[model samples]
Target chain A: MKPSDHDNEHLLHHFSDMDQQRESAKLGMWIFLITELLLFGGLFGFYTFYRAWNPDIFHNAHAALDVRAGTANTIVLILSSVTIALAVRSLQLDRRRRAGKFLLATVALAAVFMVIKYFEYSHKIHLGQLPGKYYHYTGIEGTNPHIFFSVYFTLTGLHGLHVLAGMGFIAWLAIRTFRNHFSAAYFTPVEMAGLYWHLVDMIWIYLFPLLYLVG
Target chain B: MAHATAHKKPHVLPLKVYLRVGAALLVLTLVTVAVSFVHLGPYNLVVAMLIASLKATLVALFFMHLLYDSKLYFLVFASALGTIALFIVLTLFDTLRRGDIYEEVSRPITPDAVIYSDTARFDTAHGQALPEEGLMPLDTAGIVSPPLDTGEIGEQVDTSDIGRIRTGPGEGGR
Candidate 1:
């Protein structure tokens, strides 16, 4: 066995071996992801009720949102997910520089997504389409249009927060990649981070259509 | 020759499959946008949600590598979905039941009560008059009626009072 492998064994002492450590970390990520889903799950449940009760208002409100921006963000996130996967793959091949480059690309793509989202949200707010108590779009006049905006803001706001958090994780992984901290046998952190970033992307895949495309 | 036996089997998907999956996701997004233009009533919402779910599945299976992960991960995911489903069903049941109570309470108590009215009384130089009760005239007459104890419009029904509507349990027992 390599001397470095023996030295690395003590680095993650929670497990008896590196394989066990990798498995546990992956499992821990899935559990965290499950909790994350449930957090969004409550908002989704609220949406279903409001949509069923006020379908017309929900549809008309949804029509006001920009589908093009949503679609662009979806594509951007999907591409980022691909790049992050490639970063993991590069790490697995012991190419730290390639992994670092891919991580940087992933972060840049995420920044692009956030920029698009900022414009999308600000445009709506400028048009007096604020959510909940801040809603000022009395022109579209409905019995309770505020409810639709409430669900829209709550769901997308939570998802956007996830994107920001994912960016931080990606930045951390990028720093580690720069330091040549990960190799074929020690890339669990990068892999776990990739899995989480992909989940964030997966959520946007659903949100784009639900909030923007459909009317 | 001995080095060949030491290599571990690759567990990842072929590169072509990933590319194809990516292409399919792109196509699905286009399909979703196209579908949204049609006015399908309630089905419009259903179709959009269904398409979004399909796209989410593709990303989860391929991009997230859940296809090769342990069953424990899937169990965790399934449990989350199950919890969401429970919340949807129970909350909808409660909300829909409340709608029925609203309908019952909104039913008029008398033929004259068929038209909903907001009663306002004004004091003037002349005698008091109930506006909807015809004590006030079409153009010239000015009369005021003290806020009478006429009771609620549906008060005679004994079941659809404000208390019942507010509490949701009085008339919603069924």
Candidate 2:
């Protein structure tokens, strides 16, 4: 082993250097994201089947949900995704301060998404519209409206948890950026976190329509 | 050699592309909401889901950089999706088959005997209180009624009894 091999603490010693480590990390994250998509895919399939079988019930239940809030959240998540991409770009350019600013913006946008989601959920619960056996909306005519609420809450709740997780990840990346931990040559952390954040945003892109915009 | 590779140029998308992607997403959201108002029957849900899937693809491709990922990552993603597809098909088959099983079970039993008179009356009223019948005159009375005893219902249907027979032979015994 050469003297350069001694500095392989960050490189994991298995790969040749930092570039390989970065590539591996990026690949691993993509694989993890694929699994995440699959995890949610089951719910998506459930929604598809139930909606196909009981279109009227799903549409009526979906109408009870707030489309305006969902649309606002969709925009918020999309903008945050853009900001995180820009943060990665800034890091690639070795603009640490600019990168931190973009990351902070991304975090703020994520907070906005969560705040909007919180209000939407509280409004629904206040109106006695809950998931599963607790659903109380009886005026609407449907075979099993509870099933709609069941899938709605399950999918959106899982997506919300992911958004929370992404917020924490972005915050950590922001802190590291502030400390000048990433450079043009070593910004894989920011890139990987951006990918995860984008996945969270992507899931909402589908959820907004499936849950709130359905007629 | 690896250090030299690390010094190579990084891949980055232009700001304009990001802006355009954002605009496209916003447009798609509006389009989906607008399309929901028209009654397309079965197609409405299909169209909505398709648009949502398209939106997800855009985000995954441009925002998440799946477009830039290596082939191995794509394979991993494809396999996961394939597994999820199998899960969906199998579960749906089971659910659909359950309805058939329920119908077969109901055919062997006398349904009218198992029906609750109060429940039947409530349904007959079109989910409203019929003033003429004077049944359940007060809303609170229905809610405050004593809970039905499971043992009583079970005892009423005995296997040895001819008129009131258990639907399943081993059901009540357990």
Candidate 3:
């Protein structure tokens, strides 16, 4: 028997083996991620309805968004995704310390993303380009300009929360890695967390183009 | 258990693969952003979405390791995406159709066809306007009364000319 084949303590009693346990966890995470997708799907549906109904308004309102900030955030998320994936790969190689460092790098990148997002949001708020009834910006020349901002804020806001949650998950993984809790045999949590971070990046992949570029 | 199988090792991709996918995503991101600047008119959305989908596929297949993993994960993810497509398509069908209905229903009535000369209010084609007090019961039985206007209030709302106003394009309730 190979040394790596020995089952570690991470295997649950219900699972027949480590492979089954890891596959189960990964499958469960994918399922939950889809649920998250569905939740965002509803908002996307709302956006489609409004954009279809008032194409002119959506087009005009999109100009209010800072594309520079959005592009920066997009790059930040893609980099974070890389870092987190590397972190998982590190764990797979049993480089626990390196895994923690990569995880911390991802966290730092996520924080930078939030900072850029904060500036964009505050700028919008300062200009009264808010969602719904609070919308008072008079620059847009169309009916119900507020509707576009409403969809924008809601979609990005929810996505931001997901980013925050991913950061938390990665931070937890980093802590666990420092404690020497995971190795090549039992890094399901790190892999799962990496999947989640990628999912978050995937969401931004769509959101960036739709909200900022598509108009 | 029936599902129990031999221990399978996790797949670990090389650093180059991750780096390559990461570079591709960044390039695609820039391409999408750059594409937005060129006015494709309506096709802007199409092109942007296509590029973004390509980027998302790369992330799913490589960074998320769906390419290396079992097909079951891809199945679940693809089905979820299909469901979202149905949600958006069905919703748009309803919303766009409803918009057409509203446009048809709310058309403005033309001003030339005078229904009630006394009030000059566009007759809602229903002719449910109350007849003046002490006046003969309105001949609301589809009688084409002359479009006469005395231009005086309470001058006996001409029941004889009661239903003559041909309701214009605004007659939508029918």
Candidate 4:
């Protein structure tokens, strides 16, 4: 198809037009998110297996987690998701300045999430509630107290990496938005990044309750 | 070349949609955290998971645009979720119901099974050679081979030193 006025420079030749291109990109991103879900699903399975085996131990070990910090991080991530979604919406409306601000807010919230995560991890390290053979905390009564920490570190550690990646995505979108690279005609990147950010938040939504508030 | 198909303009949802979804998500987050504190026994997990699922659905439908986008995206995502459910459920089936039938016999023998127990001996002299008394019946009762004299070999190899992770079959090289 020949390039037309409706088609922006962002639209690739492989697609019929901007709509097709945007939908294709979003589809691809969703597929990638599926794989990401499966990856975390495996860990979730491992967690379930161990949690079932050591119910009492899991119950006790989870108590060591700071509910306040976890709750704070949860709110931070949810708010970040909101900001990224708003950023996409703003871009769709051709409000470039507002979109940039929303993107910046998302990045700032992501940093706040990481800072809280840093304190949580350092506190665990201090208490010697380390995973595997390095576990030295004797406060919890369990045959293998390290098992809970092992699952804890693996789940949250992986999720933290995703948070950092999401931050990078939003920051890049922010820079691009400020440069006027995205507008109402083509904001696929912003939308795709929003999807990625929301997925990260979704994973944490599951993680927070499982890790911090096991009943 | 001119194409016959005219692509419809991409659907842009209203800001109100986002704000409402965002508010719902925040409220649900608070609800999940609050529910966690109520001590619902086993139901606590069920409630937590249900609330989390609801929040995830809202994000997927509104924030991620699945509600406004093509059904293909929703199908692809739901399939992934179904697969994950299978993954977790099948794993739990194996682990949670293990040893339900045969009890102790069906369960996996621990690494410290008597055959690899502290008192069990590794006859390095035999090293893949058939026993002089011919093949013995399989026994997990810890008596796989007779104990050999350590002094004759000039070095005592303590199998127990391998601890919980006793390597099998290829230890003859040591």
* DockQ, candidate 1, vs. native dimer: 0.25
How far is B170's C-alpha from truth in model 4 (Å)?
Answer: 24
- What residue runs in model 3 are displaced by over 4 Å at the alpha carbon? A1-7, B1-10, B104-174
Please give the RMSD of candidate 3 to the true structure. 11.0
lDDT of 1 at A84: 89
Off by over 4 Å in 2: A1-10, B1-9, B97-174
Model 4 bad stretches (over 4 Å): A1-7, B1-10, B101-174
Candidate 3 backbone collisions, by pair? none
The TM-score of candidate 4 is 0.80
Using Cα atoms, each model's DockQ against the true complex is 0.25, 0.28, 0.31, 0.35
Residue A122, model 1, lDDT: 90
Q: Of 2 and 4, which scores higher on DockQ? A: 4
lDDT of 4 by residue, B25-101 (tens): 88988888889889789999999999988998898888888887889999999999999999899877766664343
Q: Give candidate 1's error at residue A15 in angstroms.
A: 1.8
Q: What would the per-residue lDDT of candidate 3 be over residues A73-173, giving only the tens digit for each residue? A: 99999999999999988887778899999999999999999999999999999999987657778898865687788899999999999989988988988
Model 1 C-alpha lDDT per residue in residues A159-210, reported as the tens digit of each score? 8898888888888889989997887667888898888888888778777877
**Model 2 alpha-carbon miss at residue B73, Å:** 1.4
Candidate 3: which docking quality band?
acceptable
